[model samples]
Target: MSPDTAPSAARVDPKLLRIAFILVLGTFMATVDATIVSVGIDTLAGEFGASVAEIQWVSTAYLLAVVAAVPASGWLADRFGGRRTWLAAVGVFLLGSALCALAWSATSLIVFRVVQGLGGGLLPATGQALLARIAGPDRTGRVISIVAVVPLLSPVLGPLVGGAILGTASWPWLFLVNLPIGLVAMLLARRHVPAVPPSERRTAFDLRGAALLSPGLAVLVFGLTEVSHGRTLPAAAGVSAGLAMLAGFAVHGLRTRRTPLVDPRLFAQPPFGAAALALLVLGASVFGTMFLLPLYFQTGRGLSAGEAGLLLAPQGLGAAAGSVLVNRTIDKVAPRALVVTGIVLILVGTVPFTQLGHRPTDALIASALVVRGVGMAMVSAPVMNIVYSRIEPAHLPRAAGALNLLNTVGGSIGTAALAVVLQNRLTARGPDIAQAFADTFWWVLGLCLLAAAGATRLPRTHVGKS
Candidate 1:
C-alpha cells in the first residue's frame, strides 16, 4: 500500500483517497514553492546582475500576489465549482512557472512570480473546502489528518529541495520543476475529482469587500516583511493602512446584504472562533520558529544551509508520526484534550532552544525538534478537523478562506515580531548570539501558551456530534 493510503485506507473510500492524493500534490507544490526560491535568491541576483534588494522582489511580489488572490478563491470555488476552479489554478500556476523559467531579466521574473502566486494562493483553502465537502464531518478528521502532512513537511523540505536543485541544475529548473508535477496533478484531477455544481444562492460577488480585503492583506504582509528587514517608516505606513482597511472591511462585512469576500463574522462563531484564534497563534509559533531555526543553525552553530536543513528533518519525521497518531485518534479524542496536549508537547520541545546558550548536543536538538514537530501536527490537525466538521457545507469555502488568511497573516506577523526580537537581542547580548536565540525562543514559548489558552475554548467532547 502507498504511504498516502496509510493508517485508514479501508475506512475511507478509495476514490476520496485518490482525490486527496491529487489535491496534496498541488498543495505540496505551492507550499514548497514559497520557500524553495529563498535559497536561490543569491544565485538569481548574481545571474541577473542585480542587487539583493532588486532580486528580493522575486519572492516579495509572489507573496503579495498570493495575499491578493486568496480572498477570491472562495467565491471562485462557489461560483464555478471546486474541481474547475482547482484545475484553473493549476493551469495558471504552470503558465507562470514556465514564464518564470524563460524570463529574460529580473523584472520579468518578478512579474512572472506574481502570476504564479495568484494561482498558488488559491490552492490550499480551495482544496480543503473541496475535500471537506466530499468527506463530510465524520471522516474529515481521518482524511484531513492525512492531508495535513504535506504542509507540515514543506518548510523543512523546501530549502533542501532547492539546494539540491541548485547543486545539480541551473536556477530556472527551480520553476521548471513545477511543470511535470502540475501537469500530472491536473490530469489526475480531471479524471478523479468529480465536479460539484455551483452554489444556487445567486448572490453577486462582493467587489467592495474584495477591494478592501485583498489589498489590505497584501499590504499588511508587505509591511510585516518590511518589519523583518528593519525598514521602520515603510513598515509603519503599510501596517497602519492595512489595518485601517481591514477594519473597514469588517464593518462592511457586518452591514452588507451580500456575502463579504471572507466573512469577518465567521471569527465570532463558537468552536470556530476558538479554532481560528488557535490557528492564528499556531501559525505564528510554527512559522516564527521556522524562520529562526535556519538562522540559528547557520549563524550561531556554524552549520551550512544543507546541514541546517538536515537537522530540521527530524521535525518532519515527528510531524509525520504525529499525523498518523491524529488520523487514528482524532475521532476518539476531544479537541480540547488533543490541542492542549499538543501545546504542552510544543512547550517541551521548545525548552531546549531556550537553553541554547549552554550549547546543547546535536542529539538533544534533533530530539527536541521532533517533539516540536509532533506538537505542531497535533495542534493543527485537530483544529482543522473541528472547524471542518462543525460548519455547514455551504460555508466551507469562505470559512476555509478566512481560516487560511488568518493563519497566513499570523505567520507574517509572528515572523516579523520575532525578527525584531531576535535583532534586539543580538545587539543587546553582544557576541552571545546563541544566548540571543535562546531569549527569542522564550517568546515562541509564550505564543504556544497563548494557543493553548485558545484551545481551552474548543469543544470539550468528541467532534462526531451533529
Candidate 2:
C-alpha cells in the first residue's frame, strides 16, 4: 500500500496499535514531567536553600527550552528520519532527567531542565507526524484519538502523582521516577518502532529563520509569564522584542525561495487555517483554566495540593470518555460538527465556575470539570484529525510543528492574560477572592465562544475520506 492511503480495515491494525503505544510512552513522560515538578516547587526551594524566585527557574527554563526546540522538530525529523529523531529525543530527555536527579544546586537543576525541554518539545509533534504517516489518512483519526488521551490527561495526573512521590520519598525521586518509564519506552521503540525515511527533497536547514522564530517564541512566552507576575518593564521589553523577531521571520518566510522553517503560507489553506485558529483558542481556554483552577482550590478554598489534585480527577475521567466517543464517531461525523459541539459542552461546563461567588458545591465543581474534560477531548482530536488527514504525507512534519507551536504559545498567553486579570481583580475587590475568580472565568467563556466561531470554518465533510 502507498504511504498516502491504506485500505480501511475492520479493526485497527495490531501493529499500528503497538507503534502508537510506544510513541505514547515518550509523549506521556514528557508531558507529565512538565507538570509533575510543579508540585515540588516549595520543597525544591527548601532543599536548595534558595528563594522562591530562584527556584521558579527550574520550571521556566524547561518551558523556554521547549518553545525554542519546537520549531526545529520538523527539520530534524526530515533530516534524521522520524524513528531516529524520536529515539534520540527520548535519549536526551532521559539524560536530562538523570542529570537533574544528580544536580547539586538550583542553578544546575535549571540548566539541566533546559536540556530536557529541548528533547521534550520535539516528542509530541514528531510522534504525531510519524503515526499519521504510518496510519495513512484512513486510520489517522482513530489511531490519534486513542493515543492523544495520555498527554491530555498528564497535566491533571502530574500533581497528584508528584504529591504521592514527594510524600513517600525525597525530592530526587521526582526526577528519578522517569527513569523506569523512559527506559521501557526506549527499549520498546528500538524493537517495535519502524523507521520512516527522511523526506526526499531535503532543503538546507534554515538557520536564519530558526534564529528569528525560535527565540521569538521563547521570549514571547517569557514575556507573558512575566506579565502574569506583574513585572511590567521586563514583560514589555520581552514582548516587544519577541514580536519584532517573529515579524522578521514572517517576512523572511514569504520571500525566501528555500523552504522556510515552517512555511507562513500553509495557514492560507482553508482547512489548515481554520483548524489552526481553533487549536489556538482551545489551548488558551484549556491551559488558562488549568492555571486558574489550581489557584482557586489552594487559595480561595484553602485546600491542600493533594486535595486539589484529587478534586480534578473527574476531568481526566471525562476526557477518557470523550476520546472513546470521538474514536467511534470521527469517521462518520464532520470535523466542524464535532468541534462546535465540543465548544458548546465546554461552555456549559465553564458556566459554574463563573458562579464561584455563590460557593458552588464540590459535587457541582467536579461535574463541571467532567463536562469540560470531555469537551476538550472532543475539540483536540477532531482538529488534529482534520490537519493530519488533509495534508500530504510528506508535509506532516512541518505542519505538526506549526500546530504545536501555536497551541503552546496560545496556552502561555492565555495563562498570562488570565493571571493579570485575576491579579487586577484581587487588587480592585480586596477581600473577595471568590468574586475575582468568578470574574476571570467569564474570560474563559469568551475564549470558548471564539473557538466556536473558528470551528464554523472547519471542513464540513468527513476529513478521513480522500
Candidate 3:
C-alpha cells in the first residue's frame, strides 16, 4: 500500500476488479460456512440431544457434498458459462442456507447442509478460473493475492461471528446470516462476471471422467470421516470402492482421446505438482488447526466462545499484513525459497500451541496466532502464481478445479483425523485436557513440517540453485 507499489497492485482493469469482488464474496460465503458451523456443533448437539458422533455428520455431510461437486465444476462452468454458473451456485447456496435455518432436527440440518455444500464447492473452483483468466500469465501473483484473501481472512473471523450469533441469537442464525451476503454476491455476478459462451472449440464433456472422479472423491472423503469416527465395515467398503474408481479415472484419462474431467495429467508438471502438494499441506495445516483452536481456548483454557473468537482474530490480521508484504517481493525470489520460508514460519508459529498449559496468557496465544497467520499468508498468496503461470491457459479450468479439490479433501481429512486424535488422547491421558489438546497440536506441527519439506521439491530457480 506504499506509494511505490500502488500502480503494480492496480494493474488489473476496472472490469476485472468488479469480477474479483464477486468471486471473493462467493468464496468467502462458501469457505467461511464450512468452518463457521463448526463452532456451533456442540450447541446444535445439545439442542437436538444428539450424540457427538451423530452431530459430526452435520459438518461432515457438508464437506462430502462439497467433494462431490468439485470434480464437476470446471466442466459445468465451461458448458454453462462461468458468470451464469456462479450466479446459479450462489442462488442455490442461499436457498440451502434458508432451509438450514428452518431445520427442526439434526437430521434435517445435516441434509440441508449438504445442499449448501453442493453449491459452495463451485464458488472457489470457478472463482479461481476467473481470476487466472483475468490476471494473465505474468501477473499471477496479483491474482493469487486477490484470491488468497478470502481463505486467509475468513477462518479467523468465522468462529468469532459464529460464536457471537450463538451466544446472542440462536443456532439457526448461523445459516441465516449467509442469506443476505449470498444474495449480494449473486447480484454482483450479473454485472461483473463475463459469460463465456459455450465454445465449439472447447473439448467435449468427459462423462466417463466425471462419473469416475466425483463419486470417487465423495466416497473417499466419506470413508475417511467414517474411519475417523471408528466405523469399520462401511468405511472399508467406501474406501475400497472410491480408490478403485479414482484409479479407473486415471487409466481412462490416459487411454482416451478426449479430455478428462479431472485430468490426472496436470500432476506431471513439476511446478503444478509442487503447488498441488503445497496446497494440500497448507490446507491440512490451516484447517486442521482452525478446527481445534477454538476448542482449545473454550475447553482447555475455560474461555467463553466469544472470548475464544476474539483471541483468534490476531491470526487473520497478521495474515492480511503478511500478504501485503509478501506479494510485493514474491516475484524476485524463486517460489521454492519463498514457500519454504513460509513453512518455517508456520512451524515456528505453530510450535507455541503445542506447549500451552492451563490458564495460558491471552497475549501468548494471540501472538502465536498472529505468527501463524502471517506464515499462512506467505504460503497461500503466491502458490497460485506458480501454478497458473506454468500451465497452459486452456487447461486453467480443470487445473483450478483439481487443485481446489485437493485442498478441500486434505483439510477435511486433516480436521477429522486430528479430532479423532484428540478424542483418543483425552481418554488415554487421564483427562489432562490441556495435554491432550497439546498432543493434537503436535499432529498439526507434523503437518507443517511435512509441508515445509515438500515445498523444497518445487522447481528451483537459478539463484535458488546457486
Candidate 4:
C-alpha cells in the first residue's frame, strides 16, 4: 500500500455515492442538532418551565452521550455489519428527535437527547471506516475530503437552520426536520452501504475495560462542564477522579491482552501517537474558540443570539473552503508543514479578536471569522489524512474511533477549561465582560501556538495523493 501504488480516484458505484451522500446527510443532521439547540435554549426554558442551567443539560447530556458511545463504534461495526449499524443509528436518531420534539418537560428532553447522542456518535467514526473500506487503499484522501465538509460547516448551518425554524415555526420543528432526512438516509443506506463480514477471531467484549473508560470520560467531561457554572472545586475533583479511572483502564487494557476496548498498541507507532496529540490540542483550540465566539458577540458587543450566529457562519464557510483546498494539496505538502501553517493561520486570526473594542462591528467579526475558518479548513483535513495514512487499512475502524473519541473529549475539556478561565477573569474584573472575553481570546491564541508546536511532531511527508 505504497503512496505511489495507490489508486488516484475511488471506483465508487453510482449507488454507493448516493448512499455516501445519505450518510453524510445523517452526519450533518446529528451535528447540526447538537449546535442548533443552543440558539433555542431560551425558548426551550420558557416552554418547559425550567431554569437556564437546567436547560443547559440538554446540550450537556447530548455531548456526554456522544463521548460515552464513541469508543463502541468500531466494536459495533464489527459485531453487526456497517450497513446494519448505520441504519440502526439513523433510526435511533430519528426516533430520539421525534421524542425530543414532543417532550413535555426538560427531563424528558434530556433523556431523548441522550438517545440522539448515542446514535450521532456512531456516524463520524463508522462513516469514516466505511468510506475507507469502500475506497480501498487508493483514493482515501479524496473521499475523506468530501466527507470532511459535513462536520466542518455544520456549526455554521446549525444556527441558521435553527433560527429559521424558530422564527417561522416552533422549537419542535428543529427535531422534526430530521424525520424526512433520516427516512431518506435509512432507505439509501440499506441499498448501497456494503457490509463487512464479521471477523471470526472470537475476541471477548472487554466489558471491564469499557466500564472503566466510558465512566471515566463522562466524569472528566462533567467536571469541565461544571466550571462554567462557578463550581471550581467539584469540577477539579471530578476531573481528577476521571484521570485516575482512565489510568486504571489503561492498566486493565494492558493486562488483559485478549481484546481491550481500545488497542494500546496503536500508540506505539510514532505517527499515530503524534497525530492523536495533534487531535487533542486541535480539538481544545477549535471547539474552545467556538464556545467563546458567541459569548463574545452577545455579552461583549451586545448582539442578539441570532446575530451572533449569523456572524459565525463565515467561519464555517471559510472552513469549508479550506477543507477543499487542503484535501487537494495534502498529498503534495508535508503533513508537518501543512499542520504548522494551519495552526499559525489560526493564531493570526485570533489576533484581531484580542484587539476588539467595546463595540465591534459585524463586518470586523466576519472578517476575523473568515480568517479563523481558513485556518480551520487548512488544519482539519490534513490532520485526518496524516492520521489515517499512517495506519494499516485493517486498523482503520478502530483507529478512527479512537481518534474521534479523543476529539470529543478534547472539545469537552477545551470548552470547559476556557469557560472556567473566562468565568474567573470576568468575576475578578467585574462589569468588564469585554475585557474578560479579550483576555480569553489571548489564552486561545496561546493554545493555538501550542497546537502549532504539536503539529511539528507529525511525520514530515506528503499525504493523500498518489
Candidate 5:
C-alpha cells in the first residue's frame, strides 16, 4: 500500500465514464448556483422589494445548509449505496432549483436555497468518493482532473451566465437554467450508474456524532457570516460556541471509537495530516481571493457584474489547463514538489492584484486572474491525487468526505475573514478602500507562501511506502 506501488488498474469502462460525467453535471449545477446569485442580488431585491439585509439571507441560508448536510454525505452513501444516494441528492437539488425559480419573495427563495444547499453539499464530497471508487488508484487522478473542471468553471461562469440571462430574460432564469441540466443528468445517471446491493451496505448512521458536528458547524458558519457583516461580538460568541461543540464532538468520537461523523484518527497519518493542513490554508487563500475579486471589479473598477465575471474567466480557464497538465504528470511528479510549486504560483498570481490602482484596467485584472487560475489548477488535482494515493482504499469515502468538509470550512473561514478585513479597511480608510484591497492581497500572498511552507513538510511520497 505504498504511494508508488501501483494498485491493479481496472479496465476503463465507458459506462463508468458516463456516470462520472453525469455526476459532474450535477456538481456543476450546484457549484454554479452557489455564486450565480451574486450578480442577481440587485434584481432579486427589486423583484422582492426587499432590502440588502433581507436579501443576504438567500446566500447565508444556502451556505448554512451546505455545512449542515456535508458531514452526512459519507454515512448516507454507505447506508444507501452511492448510486441511489447520488440520484436522490440530484433530485433534491433540481427540486430546490425549481422552487427557487418559482419563488415570489426573498423568504421563499431562501427556504428553497436551503433545500438546494442540502443537495448541493453532497455533490462534491460524494462525487469525489464515487469517482475514486470507480476509477481505482491508477486512474483516480485523471478522473478527478476531469471532475475538477466543474468547480473551476462554475464560479466564473455563474455571474457570466447570470448576467446574460438577466440581460435578456430575468433573474429567475438563473435557477431555471438548472432544470434542463438536472433533468438530462438524471437521465444519464439512471442509465449509466452501477447499483451496489443494499445487502452489502453498512447499516450504521452515527447519529450521535452528526448531532454534535452539524449544529457546531452551523453555529460557527453563522457567526463567521455575521463577522463578515461587521458584527464582532456576535461573531465572537458564535465562534466560541462552535469551538466548544467541535471539542465535544472530538471527545465523543475518540471515546466511542466506532465510526463518528468525522473520524478524527485519519489525521494520525502524516500525508493525510499535511494534506489537510495544506488544503485548509490553500482553501482560505484561494476562496479569499474569489470573494475579493468581485469587489475589486464591481466596487473598485466600477465594472458590471457580467464584466467582472468575464474578466474572471481567465482564472477558470487557467485552472482547467492546469488540471489537464498536472493530471498528465501526477504519477511522475513528487506530490510535495507539485504542491509547493502550486503555492508559489498562487503567490505570484496574487501579487499583481496588490498593485492595482484606482483605475486598474480590465486587461490588468484579467491577466492577474489567469495567473491565479493557473496556480489554483496546479494545486487542486495534485493535492487530491496525493491524499487519495496515500490512504487505504476502504477509507476513501470518509477521507474524501472529511477533506471536502475541511475545504468547505476553510472557504467559509476565508470568506468571512477576508470580508471582515475588507469591510473594516474600507471603513477605516474611507476612499482608500482600493489601497485597502491591495493590502488584503498582500495578506493573501502571505497565506499562499505559508501554504507553500507547509506543503514542504509533506513527505516526498506517502509515508510507509516507496
Candidate 6:
C-alpha cells in the first residue's frame, strides 16, 4: 500500500507490526545514547584529569547537536525516502560511535559525541513518522506505546548500563557498545522497512526557516546550560535572542508558501498542541530529573556508579510494567484519564523524595520510583501517541520532528534550571547534599503539577476522519 494514503489504525497488519518492531531497535539505541554517558562523566573526568563541570560539556554538546539535527529530519525524509534517510542516519551514528570510542582526549570525545547526537536525533523522529504512516490515528496509542518502550526505559537503564560498563570495562566501551546493536538494527531496517515512493507534488523546502529554527533551539539550550554555571546576564541575552529567532521562524512558517521546517498550524490543533505541551512538561519533570538522580546517588550518598545505577533500576522496571499495562488497556482508557492519573501518581511518588533525609533506605527510594515510573509511562506514551492521531499521513514527518524537538528542548531547560538550583544550594555553609537533592526534587514535582493542569486541555478523543 502506498503510505501517502494511510491505513486504518483498527486494522494494523502483520507487516506493519513487524516493521514497527524493527524501527524500535533504532529508537532504543538513540534514546540510550542520550543518557548512557551520564554515569561516565565522573570516570571521564578522572581519566582526563578534568573537573565534573568540565566533563558535563560531553552531555551538553550531544544535546545541542540533537537540537540542531532534529529539525532537519523532516526535510531529509521528504527529500530522501524514509528507508534511505534512515539507513544513512544509522550509518552516521555508527561512524560517530566508532570515533567516540577511539577519542584520545576529552575535547575529542566531546566533539565526537556531538557527531553522535546529530545522527541520533534522526532516529526517533524518522521512526515515529514510519509507524504513524502505517498504523494511522485509530491505533496510534498501541503502536506508540510499543515504540515508546525504549525511551521510557533508557533514561533509567542507561546509567545502570553505563555504570556496569564503567565498572567492568574502560569508559570508551560505552560508545563501543553501540557498534553491534546499530549494525543489527540497520540490517533489519534495510530488509523490513517499507519504502514509500516520493510524492509527485513537491513542497519546496524552506532553507531560511530551517536555518533559523535549528540554531535558535541550540542557542536556547546553550543558554540554559550556562544558567547552571551562574552566567545570568549572558544566559539571559542568549535566551532572549533565541526566543526572538524562534518567534521569527514561527511567523515565517505561517506566512511561507513553501514547506517550512515545522508547520505553525499544528499548534492550533488540540491534539497536537495540548499534547505537545503536556510532553514538554513531562520531559522536564521525568526525563530532566533523570539527569540528576544518578548524581544524587553517587555524589550525595557516595554510592559507587554501579550501585547508583542499580538503585535506579526499579524505576525502569516499573515503567516497562506500566507500558505493558497500557498496551493492554489503551482502547478502554481515555487519553486524558491516563495523563491526569499518571500525574497524580507522579506527584504522590515525588513527595517521598522531597522528604528523603541523609541515608534514606533503598527500599523507600525504590518504591517511590516505581510509582513515579508507572506515572511517567502513562504520561509520555499516550500524550505522544495523541499527537499522531491529530496529524494527516503526509504531515507525520513534520509532526514527529516538531514533537521530538519540543520534548528535548523542554528537557534541556528542566535539567539546566533544576541543576542550577541544586548547585546554588550546594554552596551553602556546610551544605547537606541529601537536602539539596530533595529541594531540587520539589521542583520536579512542581513541573509535574503544571503538566497535570495542561492535560485537561487535550481532546477527549481523536478527531473524526474527514
- lDDT for each residue of candidate 5 in 107-155, tens digit (9 for 90 to 100): 9999999999999989888777776766667777667766766776766
Runs of candidate 2 with Cα error greater than 4 angstroms are 1-6, 464-466
TM-score of structure candidate 2: 0.98
Per-candidate clashes come to 0, 0, 0, 0, 0, 0
lDDT of 3 by residue, 1-466 (tens): 3211224343666766677777889899998888788678889999999987899888888888898888888887777766677788888888899999999998999999999999999888888876676566666676577668678777778887788788789888999999888878777777656565443457788988878888898887788777766788988998899899989999998888887887777787777777888889888888888878888887877888778788889989888888887767766777777788888888888887788755466788788888888888888767777776666655677788888988888887787678778888888877688888888899998888888766887866621244
Across residues 168-252, which tens digit of lDDT does each residue of candidate 6 receive? 9998899999999989988888787878644455667788998899889888888877878888997898788888899999999
Report each candidate's C-alpha RMSD, comma-separated, in the order given. Answer: 3.2, 1.3, 4.0, 2.8, 3.0, 2.2
Tens-digit per-residue lDDT, 360-439, candidate 1: 99999999989988998998889998898888777888888888877877776788789989998998999999999999
In the predicted model 5, the residue pairs found to clash are: none
| lDDT measured at residue 88 in model 2 versus the true structure, 0 to 100 | 92
Residue 94 of model 2, lDDT score? 91
Clashing residue pairs, backbone N/CA/C < 3 A, model 4: none
Error of 4 at 258 (Å): 1.6
Residue 306 lDDT in model 2?
94
* Per-model TM against the reference: 0.96, 0.98, 0.90, 0.94, 0.94, 0.94
RMSD in angstroms, candidate 5?
Answer: 3.0
Report the Cα lDDT for residue 75, model 6.
76
TM-score head-to-head 3 vs 6, winner = 6
- For model 1, the stretches where C-alpha displacement exceeds 4 angstroms are 1-10, 464-466
Better of 1 and 2 by TM-score: 2
Return the TM-score for candidate 1, rounded to 2 decimals.
0.96
Residue runs of model 6 more than 4 Å from their true location after superposition: 4-14, 49-51, 232-234, 358-360, 428-430, 462-466
Off by over 4 Å in 4: 1-19, 358-361, 463-466
lDDT of 4 by residue, 1-466 (tens): 4222435564545654565676687778877887888889999999999999999999999998888888888787777756677778888889899999999999999999999999998888887776666665456655666677677677678778888899999889989999999898887777766666554455677799889898899988998788678787988898899899899998897888587888776776777777777777778877788888888878877888888888888888778777778767766678788778888878877887786645566687788888788887777667777777656665676788898888778788889999989988888779878888888888888878777777777878654443
Q: Which candidate, 3 or 4, would have the higher TM-score against the true structure?
A: 4
